[model samples]
Target: MAPTESNKRLALAIIDFLGSSLKDGTLTADDAESIEIAQSCIADTFKVDPTDEAAVKEAVGGQSLASIYSVYEKLRSKSTPQAGSASTEQSQTDKPKTGAPTAESDKFKSEGNALMSRKDYNGAIAQYTKALEIAPGNPIYLSNRAAAFSASSQHEKAAEDAELAVSVDSKYSKAWSRLGLARFDMGDYHAAKEAYEKGIEAEGNGGSDAMKRGLETSSRKIEEASRGTEPPSEELDSAPGASRGGGGMPDLSALAGMLGGGGGGGGMPDLGSMMSNPMFANMAQNLMGNPDMLNNLMGNPRLRQMAENFGQGGGMPDMSSLMSDPNIADMARNMMGGGAGGAGGAGQGGQGGQGQ
Candidate 1:
């Protein structure tokens, strides 16, 4: 599939940022080869040509590196595709045999969905791709693969599959939701919101709670994004329910209490405090539901030590590492996009989180 306009723009933004950094001496001459490699990867990801300098430059036009990277961080998901190819057969657990039967294809599809539920997105995408190989042009397969791609940080590819899915069957509400979600992750909130609206219409506007919740989240994002420019920090304090300066940000002190220290009642967070404290609440919720995410959170050195400290009955230790993680902060911002944030959609937050 050809790259979406959003994907092309992303590739261009990355190239332009690297080019500017090199020119400004912030990125050294020694980094040129690595920069070229990064550019090539972006090109492959978006189906653009690395050799076409003019096209690359035009797409970037004028966008900040910080902004581009923010979108990158935003779109990243739970799994990683190999650097330059999505069709690498070695990653696949079940490769489609030549002329595989329809039943065989369906079997692979079921396995893919199972992996997706388990948060094994890489395995899921591989299985989905294999299913597609057997049953080419299957819209349901396309939409399923798209969801897996989105889960695996393959937003551009996800968008490609989603677009294909919708074109194949206009009534496929799941595909519509997948498309909207992929676009949202790529920072195309307007398009995302529109797609969700379309999806609701496609679902007859009163179908599943999943679709309704999607519309609500997308609408919330549209509202948040319409703020134009931030008024100022002073103005933020006056905004409803926003606690500025004093402690608007998350209080890391709550994590120890939330994360399995007290057996039952004593450590449980009150709804009021939990609602007031987004960062801790988010972590707590994710930890409860996603074992993989819990592993990631605990894998951080500081968090590991925090666990040790908690076991020894220490008070709140330094959570600077968890607090300072750009990925975590971005996830928090995206989730609270409910407040000043709304980067949009549940799937927009961390999994294959970039360290940068």
Candidate 2:
């Protein structure tokens, strides 16, 4: 018989025997060793080696006899014959027979990873689902399916799968990270933080660093939201010039000092002096002259208060001296015409001469 047909026949016989052993609870370590040896024999007969470290990982499923048979079948199918016709026939005869799973869970895992890489999350989920069906209670498969659910934005489903994976194997760091992300999406920041911390604890500081950072960020956001602050930040409270009253408005004295110096001697003029300035009076009149403009410009409460201050003649500085200064007068003349001399025409020629 050909190697493929021999492998298939052996696999059937092993599966049959394993099934019977399950009901009788007669599957022993010797039986498991026998299956492993048969798998190795099939691999060698086909000139293939079962040296893949991943292949040696936890058997496709838990330590059930049927699952072991499934693993043996998978190994035999993967071991392709490489010899000539006569040698192939001899190899097949020398190979041991065994049973295997109806499906290859590892293949499903690989296909799911490939689909995930392509961002076909739903397709990846299907592959992972198939893998879980073949090897139920597989922590790795559950974690992988959880990742697919997360990518598809099915956060609730992702959380459930991640929780199952962690329950299956508490040390599964990837599953813990996935659980954190799902919980974070569902607005369970505290739970997410705990999950991420658990992941970091299991994997040390290596593979769980990103999850740790995520926990820190989620904690900060939750704190900020609880405090009713937008544009969240950890250092917001320490910002310079920030006021109390939940960051309402700056104090009036602070605003005044910022606009100009205060109280005498090179400081801004007092309210009476400012109101007496003709230029200040002109600007004030111009602004209040238009009711529509005033309403539109002072719609904000803070701005309206500032406008009221300006109206009270307490806010403005003395501008009369500035407007009347000789340099300013000359500059104004030059601007109105081409030169001070032109603006000061013939009647004021002597006045320009006095400055010269």
Candidate 3:
């Protein structure tokens, strides 16, 4: 008789089981190579391709072989009255009915952890499900399952589990990290960044290295998506402007904008707002403290012309001339880049200059 689809599916499942075992270190390297040879032979005999995920899914009804085996184990454990079943039943009766981490749940969680270590994501998920049955709202169980779900490429489920874990225990840093990773995988960079930020806040002591790295990556993604350019390395730091004091040069374009500096528009720019702006205030402070920068600005021909005209009582001399100066324009461009890069790093006291 010709090999049926059922026969091919069985072979595929066995192949998957062997691969999972190999990943979990249940099989030695030589055993794995032998198993690989056996798998090829099985594939040839059954005319089945284990790599055909669609066929495998269809054959197994969308569940991994490990998941199906887990179900079988549960059913078998219940049906077959083994010698240890009486003791197991007694232990279950002795545990509390409410709250998390019953003996049974812990056992399941340990199994899940083992499966996770072996890279058996579906198997781990099944074990975690069993754990969650005993302790539905347990953050650790939810978080572990979320990790398994993420490993298995079920990002939406991972996010859901991570969110539930955090909701149950807001202080859980791992849950928050998992949530950030899930959100990032979904391309929600803003949400990922917020999650990482919350995770850091929950951690209190500057957060874990993993959480910090996640935050930095998400921040970079946000900057790239919004600004269409690479973000400055310092901007990834928690406080962008804390180290770079107000000594940095001011945004020249902003100063010009405040003094009616752009093209065509003749009326004076909002000097009141300009005075209130953190960038302009920093610029004025820097110029006052750094005579060299001020001299450099004044030495530019266009700025010299404007200053000369203004000195002669020509009120509000055309700032276009000042802005058009190559030296001034170059300074403005550099300052503008810095301002934009650190805009999000502006502290409560407005230490960082706003992008013009």
Candidate 4:
């Protein structure tokens, strides 16, 4: 059979490609001599000049020979062998098998990850779905798809995929973390907390910092719901003396003075009246118990100065200064209940009673 014009052109293109590989350093200096020799041999056999720009262009047909060969390889890999007559091998080749990642499935997963990096959640989902089709019970694929779903704000679908992933492999900590995040986004705090706990258990070495933080946040939310308190907003708009529109810190000016324990009169004020206010009492007790809160308080130079002033009977610490510390501000918002009481009169009378 005579070689077709296209086949001749293809051979020319191969020779041209080999020359290019050497020039472009694709073939290292060590292999340059061998590559040049191979290119000359191919050009001689094909009766083509690989260095002839016009001939090379015509042979390449606007696309590189490497690209064309890549297409050929892909098609060959996907092609299944046919049998003259039906046989067990033929039947098995036709039969669809699913489970575990194959090379083909892994390629899809890599594509999905690339799409995810580009924030193409829909495209990533499609690629992940293709991978899952080839490997149905793959926890990693399911977890990746779940992350894509979550990124797209499809919380329900994300939760479902995450749950399936965890069910397939309970020890998959990332899957459990995804499940917890999905639940948390859906406002299912208790469920989120449980999932985070499971994730922590799955991670033998005390779990990742992110997982532990998620667990703490979920637990805080559950506690807030039970205590009928709203989580602190990003901006603490309801500080002391701010108009009480459903939420605000109570006036702590007098309580601050009492904490200082009266100076000129020289005696500690009776704390009975101050402790009677549930908001004040609860906050005081919680603040005293919280090591983090105490540490933050003691670490702040301004706060420590205010505390010293109170001890020297310096009256109320400046509300503005006290609220400036974000830790104290958040604590005040989270612990303070919506209640009002006359602490000024209480402080004065308690001071008098103690002085007598």
Q: Give all TM-scores, in the order shown.
A: 0.37, 0.39, 0.39, 0.41
Against the correct fold, how does model 2 do in TM-score?
A: 0.39
> Tens digits of per-residue lDDT for model 2 on 233-299?
6554343232323333323233233334235434456544554777645433433332222222223
Model 3: residues with Cα > 4 Å off, grouped in runs = 1-99, 229-356
Put down candidate 1 lDDT per residue, 62-179, tens digits, no spaces: 2255544543443233123456765454546664433343887899999999999999999998898788666665778888989989988999999888876665556788998999
Instruction: Return the candidate ranking by TM-score, descending.
Output: 4, 3, 2, 1
Instruction: Tell me the spans in candidate 4 whose CA falls farther than 4 Å from its real position.
Output: 1-97, 229-356
Output the better candidate (2/4) by TM-score: 4
Q: Clashing residue pairs, candidate 1?
A: 77-352, 337-341, 337-342
Q: Which ranges of candidate 1 are over 4 A from the true structure?
A: 1-101, 230-356
Estimate candidate 2's alpha-carbon lDDT, on a 0 to 1 scale. 0.59
Estimate candidate 3's alpha-carbon lDDT, on a 0 to 1 scale. 0.70
Give me the displacement of residue 186 in model 3, in angstroms: 0.6
Once all C-alphas are superposed, what RMSD does model 2 give against the true structure?
20.9
Name the top TM-score candidate: 4
lDDT of 4 by residue, 1-356 (tens): 75677867887888877777878878888988888788787777767766677777677654467755653453344333445634335556654443468888899999999999999999999999899766775789989999999999999889888877776667899999999999999999998998899899889789999999999999999988987775555665433221222333333443454356433243444556557778768866544333233333334455557767867768767798778754455545544521223233222333343343
lDDT of each: 0.64, 0.59, 0.70, 0.70
Error of 4 at 8 (Å): 72
Runs of candidate 2 with Cα error greater than 4 angstroms are: 1-103, 205-207, 229-356
Q: List the residue pairs that clash in candidate 4.
A: none
